[model samples]
Target: MKKILVVGLFLIFACGSESKAQAPDAVKKTFQAKYPGENDPDWHQDDHGYFEAHFKIDGIKYRADFNADGSWVETETSIKKKDLPKAIKDVIKDKYGSEDISEIEKVDSASKGVFYDVEFKQKGKNKDVEFKADGTIIG
Candidate 1:
């Protein structure tokens, strides 16, 4: 009886872990079709009820967010600060001269053009700023 109980418990734990590691079928299929990459991706459900795909293609890391129904939302990818448009970089540097930029991400959206979101720490507080393609601050 003890042997059987141990085996059952092991199986239950294994099954739970396996299922948690898999993304839902619809979300997985949509990501595979859109990404069209050779590598498998991981899926996560965000607090906003959106499915997000975290993967890499051609060696560049990316996270693509999708709705529950498999509709594409946006992709967030890290980018070098120098890769940003000169005007945008200049504005950021000039405005936040004291703060150091920790990270920059390129946000690609279906409905809007690409934008850069920069994360910085200022006076012990963390802040993020969004800039449009033309160097204008949107948020």
Candidate 2:
């Protein structure tokens, strides 16, 4: 009947509108605008109607994604220099006698607190160490 046809048409339009609303640029712009940073968005669409964006804003890197319905999926903050724990740096200085190290990472633990993981090259040997929050060796 005429009612069935109208309902079908409305459903089609509604679905189309929903699809349009999930565009990657719209999500990226929303983030950039709210955060006041550059728009660096890389979008990926999957079978589950999810999209992901890897971007950096205000010197901090982030990965943010949205679902098909334009809702936020998740966000992961990138580790930066300022986020490194001081204990790890102290351990490197004490053990290696030099502060020349790379790939310093700080990992947070529930009970053990924050730990520093780093890679150091010395005397032709590459060493990896883990230090506790208070500059004590945990590895």
Candidate 3:
């Protein structure tokens, strides 16, 4: 009886972990078709009920989001401040001259199109600013 109980508990734990790590088949297929040759992405469900695949390509970290039905939503990659367009850089320098930039990411969204997300720390709080390639603030 003791042996059987131990084996049953081990199997339960193993199955639970496997299910948590595995994404739906549709989501995996879409990700593979979109990002061919990329494997072993860390998957998690986001707050918006979307599945996010976190992976790296050529040393740059990237995140790709997909809907439950396997539809692609967006992909984002971090970028350096210098990599931002000259217009955006100028605007940031003018408006946020006092704050230091903490992070920058280039986002390609299905609905909103492409934009840059810039983060700044002001008064011990984090502020995120979204800018278009032409330096227009959209969000």
For each candidate, what is the lDDT? 0.81, 0.60, 0.90
**Candidate 3: residue 127 Cα off by (Å):** 1.4
**Which digits, one per residue and each the tens of the lDDT, describe model 3 over residues 1-139?**
9999999999887664223345789999999999999989999776677888999999999999989898999999999998999999999989888888899999999999999999998776799999999999998
Candidate 3 structure lDDT: 0.90
- Give the clash count for each candidate: 0, 0, 0
Model 2, residue 66: what's the lDDT?
A: 67
> Candidate 1, TM-score vs. the true structure?
0.77
Which has the better lDDT: candidate 1, or candidate 2? 1
Q: Per-residue lDDT of 54-133 in model 1, one digit per residue for the tens? A: 88877899988788777888989999988999988889879987788889999998767688999997677779999998
Using lDDT, give the best candidate's number: 3
Ranking by TM-score: 3, 1, 2
In model 1, what lDDT does residue 132 have? 94
Top TM-score prediction, candidate number: 3
Please identify model 2 stretches exceeding 4 Å from their true place.
1-58, 62-86, 109-113, 122-125
Candidate 3: clashing pairs of residues: none
Task: Give, for candidate 2, the lowest lDDT window spanning 10 residues.
Answer: 16-25
